[model samples]
Target: MAEPTISVIIPAYNAAAFIAEALLSVLNQTSPADEVIVVNDGSTDNTRQVAASFEPHFGGRLIIIDQANAGVAAARNAAYRRASGELVAMLDADDYYLPAFLATARRAFTLMPDIVLFFGDTEIVDANGPTGRLNSEGKPVRTLPAIEIDGLFKVRGSTFTTLLEGSYIPVCAAAVRRATALAVGLFDLSVRTSEDRDFFCRLALRGPMAFSREVMAHERIHGGNISISTHRVDLARNVLTVMRKLRRPEHACLMSDQERSALEAVYKDEFFNYVYNLSSAGWRAYVKGVAMLPADERLAALHPKHLARALAAAVGMSSND
Candidate 1:
């Protein structure tokens, strides 16, 4: 069977220094992408020039879309709108795919015909150079039983629960069926941080997903990453928003009774964590956190002592209290 065409979407913002390496990575893919779409999201740098420079080299397969400074989510949505392929893959301007990345994703798709999303391990890169694999807490990326398709091996499973706990799949290391993406919709523009998590969570809810054991991409860790620049309170708020979205009645159809119960437990834990983080901010933030809590458990789990402490902090109480 002929391999399905894959379109790669890259949202770049003042990424002139690193965009070329990212484009090169796609160009060097063992199984070339059907098209490479680079959306220059109101870049102040020469990102447009750098991206356009590669169009001729790729025989016009490289497509560049220039949009006013809207934000990463908008930029990605723009590129996604123009993508024409069976599968849509994502890579950040500062990140690049390993040579075998596309091949591995295709293999996973072929073997797990029922799945819509595929992701693999990622190697973290920094100024010092290639560092190590991305992990959760201190645990390395988890392994699962393997299945072979054609000549490649991939593990099949549902990452919905894992994704709800925390995002382990980096955008650069994952691919989704174009149909699945359209069904799931675009990234949430309101979420400046953890937008990828929001997008992945929605996709995970839609259907099954799988993973490749091999490291298929590079995730660059730098000061420019949105997660690094966004305020902790705002980040926590966005996370809470995603958690709420997952628990909505419309999304509840995605999981069984047991899984839904498990998710509720997770949400309970996350609620406390959110409130604790906002406790020191002041009364307004603390109230906002409380307002964001799920109706089912709002204030039920919030101890009066914790509320008093939050109020005390809001009114200039010492940390000792």
Candidate 2:
């Protein structure tokens, strides 16, 4: 097997409907990936058949692995373990990359030899069409010392706090050195949701991150999105887990003061989500969250307001009151 300089790892579930487009996007890259590995996570659909169809076209460059019904984190880890490329790019089976993605990655690496991870801008599209740039609750992504080339803003490093504000880097839009990913221990398998937050935070700690302002990836928003399909309460709980994980002693030093503030803000947002989003149900989840989180003045200060809102909501009192 010829060693691939860049290995694309794709974790597919029952994504037979879209895996072909995803694989074709990779194959059509302006700078092609040396290898593409697809981990089929026990998809009942014909996902394997679709992925295998491209093997001949890729001429031995496409590799497929079959695994039990593991979550995305486990599937990614499985593909990572089998990947032999110096650089690893992650793509979900349902999402596809733009032709310039690999070219931008290669150029970014050439510009900054020490770049640990390079992520491009993403455009969110549904069955309709392009919506706009991905908007998270956090501040927009901007470079510290930005240089514009071919309409792409090049940044030397992306602030950890900026990332902690929200999920700025979509997995499909990001690429990392194989060694950097392994050193950071790959994705956290125990986490079922918000795993990207945990992984990206840890990755940012290892070295500098580069940003390509151009939208080089397309994020498909469908009802089947795991983060969207899951109940909000469950999503809130998983986000809390990520928050607590970031607060661990070993990871604490990795956060700057601003990053800590951003994390706290995210905690408050979670508090609102789990505590006040659905009144009684939210109250129950919020109580569990309170028990889970360590006592902090920041959280304490926001409790009464959230509690009042939850109670008011329970009593059918509108905010107009």
Candidate 3:
């Protein structure tokens, strides 16, 4: 049999309510994936059942793996190992892709044979309604344009620094060459929130990435999402830890000074944001951010605005305490 052109990996927990839609989206793709692998990560709900129901529809095209609740990173890694496609794409169980996703990716890869990664714009939807399509910053970005190789780092200023700010590249909207994904190593299992950011940083350092202007997926923002709930503190902590690890590595030298300065600004913004955004025990979160900041002189480079914000937040917390 011919090798599949793309493998779509979906890591599902208790996503019964939305997994069906996610599966249907892949099955309906204009340039359908060669294989769809859904890993049911010890879901207590009917997630397995929902995945099983689609078995007949996908036939040999769908492969399901059941494992104990080992986290999304582990589930994705397992699926990646089982995939036989030349390219690997990921979609969260709660999200679904547009029909043109794979078709555009195929064309992009054909045109830019050297590019190792491809990602496009996404439509952000919530329980209330469709909010509209957005770029990585949650800003409305219309028009799809092919980005030049240097444009990725040039526009972003610093790739690593931009990553420290936040995840602009939504994992669900990304497709990567199989070899490139494997070479970069699978997503960091230790990071619960910023695994995609860590993976993207590593990949960007290795090769060029393609950003498609097309909106090819819908990212659902529900109450149950990790980003929406109170775990924002945990997310902040994990992202800081990942950033610290990246900075200490020899690869950190690959980034320009401008990128490094941008990263410092991101660290300060993240620290201040966590301090002000905490609904419960603001002092505790502030303490956590302070504890996470690097000890070196680099901390002195934090933006004055962020420093002021952090100070204001600290005073507010102290008064409440």
Candidate 4:
């Protein structure tokens, strides 16, 4: 009877097509997890059958729980709620970890005992596999922060504000201390999108985070991509929601004086960045962005002048209109 060191959590929903691959990734880890917890998230597909089939092999280390259909956020919440590990690594049903992911994390904890969380770069995969290892712009995917900590890298600016612009730490590829995840209240059940960004944002406020350039997981970009499939319209809106949530009265003390100030200033750029991008999607999406934008930002996005500018941006004309 020894304590479990880490639990690999796979939140599956209608992932029978890919759950087996995801499970094998965990089972084949260079440094295996102490236990594997899969929450069947009420998938109508044979995800349960596919997941449960591995039980006999796990030899009591596999725990599969079933519940009525809840979103991925809720499924993940349920796993951690019942998990008995000190640390948890998240793996989406469509995405899986590299063999060395656990080994790298174990080495990191041994070297940097103070870090509460650590994440690494991810190799992007498409329906066929490894999209030639390039980002959307056809450039090699590389981790790019200016500072080095131990063997990892971090942003030159405030990590919280840096994260505000968008998500850099791939939650699927990250490993976090269970206590820290619980202390931050896990993922917000209320938000249907950007919940991952929101959860990590809260974690960033709690302590230093390690960003290892080493590729730890493969992010599959099939048509079922969660954000695009589930909440494409809410992309900008959810980010804005997370920014506002982090600034709530209860979490005020979690931020430092500098982080607090940065939140205010960064909100402006983040607001413009997300909204303006939406504006290019068309006036309809632009209008949706306007509705989700903060009150002050709403006024700016709805202005007649900004409307003209949005039209120009949407049609490939000069936004100086």
Highest TM-score, which number?
Answer: 1
Lowest-lDDT window of 10 residues in candidate 1?
135-144
CA deviation > 4 Å runs, candidate 3: 1-4, 133-159, 224-232, 256-261, 264-321
Report every candidate's CA lDDT: 0.79, 0.77, 0.74, 0.76
| Model 2 score (lDDT) | 0.77
- Write the candidate numbers in order of decreasing TM-score: 1, 2, 4, 3
Model 3 clashing residue pairs (backbone): 144-213
Worst 10 residues of 2 by lDDT: 135-144
RMSD (Cα, Å) for all candidates, in order, is 3.0, 4.1, 5.2, 4.3
On lDDT, who's better, 1 or 3?
A: 1
Model 3 lDDT-worst window of ten: 150-159
How well is each residue in 26-69 modelled by candidate 2, as lDDT tens digits? Answer: 99998989899999999999999999999988989999999999
Which residue pairs collide, candidate 1?
none
